[model samples]
Structures are given as structure tokens and as C-alpha cells.
Target: MGKDLILQAGRRTITMETAAVAALEARVDDSFHRACELMLGCSGRVIVSGMGKSGHIGRKIAATLASTGTPSFFVHPGEASHGDLGMITRHDVVIAISNSGSSAEVLTLLPLLKRLGIPLISMTGKTDSPLAQSADVNLDIAVETEACPLNLAPTSSTTVTLVMGDALAVALLEARGFTAEDFAFSHPGGALGRQLLLKVADVMHAGEELPQVSPETPLSKALLEMTSKGFGMTTIVDSNGQLLGVFTDGDLRRVIDQKLELDTATMEQVMSRRPKTVSAHTLAAEALRIMEDNKITALVVEDPEHHPIGLLHMHDVLRAGVI
Candidate 1:
């Protein structure tokens, strides 16, 4: 009834759930390895099915598996009886989740799945349950007790189930040698996609939008180019269009402090030479790292011939969500 009592109860729940999850570490033995091996070798997608709270966790597990290189989807046990059983194939692997491991909807499909010759993987708190006995590989997700005070709510059980699901998915992912670039393909709308898939050329200002001036150009003229291009910096290039140096607002401050006349001083005399340059094909994420490490706000994108082709500013990466 009191605030301290409620807080204490909450802490107990967390401790119970944490212990339940930790117990699963020992269960990740031969059975877990066999399950991962089966899922990895499956030619068809993994069909995850469950009932009640287990179903919710199953759906999330399926999603995690799908996004992390394993082809998978959730199939409600109830619907599997109502024509959705047609979704299963001989090549597919089925992951059935149930704390009791004897849900009627799931049990009804055992015969059909067996007849179809599909491998069945069961996750249950009771390894002695019917589902476990029928499965090709049984993943024991047994927990000591529920986090609920009355020992009725599916608190710790569901948490353990979810963690076991993650273990299986991650094992398969690592076994497949799935890379970040491969993950980006599955999530083109997320930040990871932008980080791994977007190239410097994709976000950099190119052609007429590039702020550049010849090395012999006056500092005042370079300032005009920087302002016109709105990049706050201008790249200095040789007559043949090869990069020579860069002049930024920082350089302008130095010139002013030393009493150099902007109109009369050439960029070659005041510019920072050997400016940081990146390839047009380089990933935007790598470019962002380079800028952050050097404390610069912009970089020049160059072609194979060392010609300045584009300019990438930190703001560009920010707008593209690469940051």
C-alpha cells in the first residue's frame, strides 16, 4: 500500500525475471546448438507459432530473426488450424512456443507437421511436455518461478522465452556471417541503412553546388564562393582542377588576426594544405567519423583522378540521419 512497499515489490519482480533469464544460460547447450544448426540449414523461412503471451513473444522473435538475416515469420496457432497450415512446407523449420507445451491449437498441428516431414523445434518450460517429446529439438526455457506475487502471471516465463528466442536468432545470424551491409538491405528506412548504404556521392554537393576556387584566387573571392555555395568553406584547386588546399571560416579568422588584407592575399598563402579528402564511393558513416575525429565540419569528395567532384558537410550527414 505504501510507496516503499510498491518499489520493493517492483525490485523483487526485476530480480526474479533477471534470475530466470540467467538460468537459461546453462540450458544453451547441445539442444540450442542443434536448433541453430537446423534453422541455419533450413531452405524455407522459419515459421514461429504460439498462443497467448507466448504468441506476442513469438512474433517479436520472428521479427528479430527476419531482420537479422534469418528468413522467418509468425504464424498464429489458432489460424494454422483454419487454413493457415498451408503456409508450412517440408523445407521450412517450425518454432512452437508454449510455457505448458500443450496448447490445443499447437498440438493439433503436430500430426500435420510430422506428416509433411517439416522439422519441429519446441520451446517450453517443461521438457517433459508433449510438445517437447514430439519436437526434433527441444529448447528448455524453464524458469524457477513467476515474477508475479501470486505466481500466476506469465512474467518471468515470458522474459526467459524472449531471451531464448534472441539467443537462437543471434546464433544463426553469426553462423551465417551476416554483415552490416547485408542488414542495411533489409532495413532501408532505418538509421543502420543510412549508415551502411549511403555513399559520400549520394549526399555530397556536386557540380555547380561545390564550393571551390583556384589556389591563386584571392581570399576575398574564396569567401564569396563559400557564401554562394553555403558550405562555410571553399576548396582550393590547381589550374588542372586537382585539389591544392582548403580555406574555411577558421582561415579567415587567422588572416584577420594577423592583419592580412583579404582582397590582396592569395588562398595559396593562407589555405590549409593537404585538405582531408574522401572517395565518392566511400560510405557516409566513415566520412562522418573522419570529420568528427579531426574536428572539421566538411570534406572534399574526389574522383579516382584526384579531381574534386563533391563536398560533404557534417550537416549533410545529420540531415540524412547517418548521425
Candidate 2:
């Protein structure tokens, strides 16, 4: 086949699925609201079950729901028949997905689910199908046609099902007032977690690692502290440990431009006064933004009292994966 023909085929598939999703948007009725209400009111997790391609979509939906503050997980319909059905409790809610709403594996569990008195939310293409008719709430995910050329494979139908799952997850997320910090708690090892949950104090150089010098200290001594600490900068403070200013490599270059002798100049005379400072409790990502916006590489981490307690450099942010 020609390359252009392959590209055209891909475009047609996307167009078909896009139309299918747009149609699903119009069909979001009271049943969708009832499903969300049931899920929100569930004392146990949302148990999602499906067969074949629908199972794959259910797994993703369950994961999204769990990460967005709704406790949920997927159970394969085949596995549910074998023993996994015990995982479902009456306090939980079940969302069963089937393109035709007549999968034998899914239908087999209906009687048991009803016996348990658990709520069932059905997602299917056929409103009159066995699974939909047996469910407590039926969500129609019908598509006019399949994206597959033969109209046999589940394409547009599955896309609509996935979108409907997202709609339910986001509605529950908003109803629960889930915040990014809560999402970070569920994904502590992910990049978003590092950006939102990691604080500057967690990564900044503190105590002996903090490079500091007295305002009256000679610039040469401050340079020694900068070299020893390997932070490329030094914070200048008073006897009370109050921040007086900061001296960085850029300040060194400026001093060199003025032809001033490092041994004779005091830090207070050569340092950049009132250099950018951030609280130790500030988020590392916010610190990174302040550094990027000011085009600076280092910031002094202070307490609420304005006393310099630590130092943060760009490398620390990079090491923490906040950059």
C-alpha cells in the first residue's frame, strides 16, 4: 500500500473516533449523574470489570479514578468468575463495560452482584442489552459506526466508553475537592509529585553545607567560602544572622570589571544587596520558577524571621528532578 494511503487511513480513524466522542457528550443525561452519585456515596472502592478490549479501557478508568481521589481498581471479568468476585462488597460500586452489553463472562456475574445488593453501573452500546437492562444505572456509549474498515473491531465504541469513564472520574474528582497535592500523594515517585510536594528545605544546603560570610568579611574570604561550599555563591549576614546581601560569581565578575582588590573590599561593599530569597517551606518548583524568571542560579533560603538558614542552587533543583 502507498504511504499516503496509510496516512489517510489513520486520519479517517481519528475522525471517526472524534465524532463518536462528540456524540457521547450529547448523551450525558441523568443516568451519568446517578452513576457519579452512587460512586461518590460508595463506602468501598469502585470495582471496574470488563472483557477483552473493554477490560483494557476499564483498567485505565480505574487507575484514573484512584489517582483522582476516588478509590477504584479493575477486576477482569474472567478472573471475577474464578474467585475475584469476592473482592466486590455491597458497600462498593461496580462499573461493567461491554461494547455489545452481552458478554457472557460479564452477564454471568449479574445474579451474584444483585444477590450481594451492590450497585451496578453499566456502560454499553446497547441500551436494551441484558447487562444494561439488569444494571441499576445504564450509561449508553453507542457509536454510529466503527472506525475499522470492516466495522467489526471495537474502535469508536471503545473510544466513547473511555471518554465516558473520564467524565465520571473528573466529576467525582471535583465533587471530592481533590487537589494537586492530593494527586501528588498518590503519585509521590512521579514528576508531578516532585514538583508539587517536594519543598526547598528538603533539597537545600543547610547547617555546615550552607556557605555564609559576615558582611564585614573581606571579599577574598567570602570567595574561599564559596569555593569550599561549591555553591558558586555565598550569603552575607550580620552578627545576628540577619541577611545583609549575597555575593555570586556574577558579583565577582563585576568586581573584576571595577578593578577592585578582593582583599581590600568587604562583602557589604561588593555583594548584591537584598538578593532573591525564598522561604525554606516553599515548593522546589516555585523556587525554580523564581530563579528562572530572575535569571539567577542561587537563592537564599530563610525562615519566617528573615534570617538566612540555608542556600539553594540550580543544581540542587536539577538533582531533585524539579527542573
Candidate 3:
């Protein structure tokens, strides 16, 4: 084939698959609602099963459901007949996927699932097939044609099935009020989890590492502290160690423009009083937002009594992967 023919084939496949996905929006009707209801009301895990290409889609669906707080897992239909059938219980809901709605391996488990009184939901292209007929709710995933030129591949069918699964998972997630924090719990190692779960105290420089100066401290000394800590700023505390103000590299520029004597000027003379601060319990991601909004790079982490306990730097947040 010519290069142009190959490019045309790829574009045609995507166009066909896109149309199939668009058709799904109209098919999210009563059956889709019933399917969501069954899965949402399930007291135990949602068991997803399929055969062949359908099985690949099923695994992805199961993962999306599980991560979205549905509590689901995929079980190969072929394995379920060989003692794995014990995995399904009366409390669970089953999702069976098959484009033809007559996958023999998948159909083999329906009798057992029915005997156990488990709710059955089916995603199939053939509404009249045995699998769809057996399901309590059949989600129609019929596409006009396969993306494959010969109409023999699972292209458009599989895309529609996967998108239908995503629709179901998202609908159930909203029904259950699943939040980002809830999602983070399921994906603790991911970037979203770190952003949601990590707090200022978890990544801030505290105790001896914190750069602090008293209001009476000379400007030269404060600059030394800022340089030593490498935070580009330092907190100015009162006699009782309460945060009184903050001085930063920005202040240094101002002082230079005014030609102020750094050796003689005290922190109280040039420090920004009542500077923006964050509590140690504030989320690192929230701190990043505050930093971006104010166009600043660091924030003073304070205690309940307004005492400076630590310093949160943008670099710290970035290093912790909370961004």
C-alpha cells in the first residue's frame, strides 16, 4: 500500500471509532440506569467477566471501576468455570461483556451466577443473544460497523465497550459522591495522591533547618540566615518566637534601590509585616496554588498560636511531587 493509503486507513479507523463512541451517548437510557443501580446497590465486589478481545476490555473496565470506588475485579470467564466460579457470591454484581452476546466461555458462567442469585449486567452488541437475554440489564453497545476495513476486527466494538464502561463507572462515582481524596486513596502511589494527601508539615523545613530571625536582628544577619538556609527568605519572629513578619530577596532589592545600609538596618525596619502564611496542616497542593496566585515561592508554616514552626518552599513541594 502507498503511504497515503496507510494514512487514510488510520484516519478512517479513528473516524469509525469516534462515531461508535458518539452513538453510546444516546444508548445511555433506562438500561444504563438499571445497570448503574445494580452495581451501586451491590453490597460486595462487582465481578467483571468476558472472553477474548472482550476480556481485554473487561479488565480495563474492572480497573476503572475499582479505582473509582466501585470495588471491582476482573475474572476470566474461562477460569470461572474451573472452580473460580467460587469467587462470585450472592452479594456481588456481575458484568459480562461480549460483542456477539454469545461467548461460550462467558455464557457458561451465567447458570452458576443465576443459581447464586447474583445480579447480572451485560454489555453486548446483540440485544437478542442469550447473554443479553439472561442479564437483568443489557447495555446496548452495537456499532454500525467495525473500524477494520474488512469489518472482521473488534475495533469500533471494543472502543464502544470501554467507553460504556467508563460511563458506568463515572455515573456510579457521582452517585456515591466519590471525591478526589477518595480517588487518591485508591491510587496512593500516583501524582494525584501525593498532591491530595501530602501536607505542608510533611515536606516543609522545620526545627533547626528553618531560617528565622528576630525583629531586632540586623538586616545583614537575616540575609546570612536566608543564604545559609537557601530558601531565599527568612521569618522574623518576636521575643516570644511568634511570627512578626517576613523578609525576602524581594525586600533586598527594595533596600538596594533605596540605598539603605544593610549593616545598620534592623529586620523590623524592612520586613513585610503580616505576610501571607500557611498552617502546617495545609495541603502541599493548596500551598502551591497560593504560591502561584501570589507569584511567590515560599510561605511561612505557622502553628495555631501564630508561631513560625517551619517554612514551605516551592522547591520542596516540587521535590515531594505534590504538584
lDDT of 2 by residue, 189-276 (tens): 9788899899999999899998989988998999999999998999988888889888999989999999999899999899899789
The 10-residue segment with the lowest total lDDT in model 3: 79-88
Colliding pairs, model 1: none
| Cα lDDT listed for each candidate | 0.93, 0.93, 0.93
**TM-score of structure candidate 1:** 0.94
Residue 213 accuracy (lDDT) in model 1: 89
Model 3 lDDT tens row, 154-254 = 99999999999999999999999999889989988989899888989899989998999998899999999999989999999988989999999999999
Instruction: List residue ranges in candidate 3 displaced over 4 A.
Output: 227-230
Q: What are the models' TM-scores?
A: 0.94, 0.96, 0.93
Sequence-dependent TM-score of model 3: 0.93
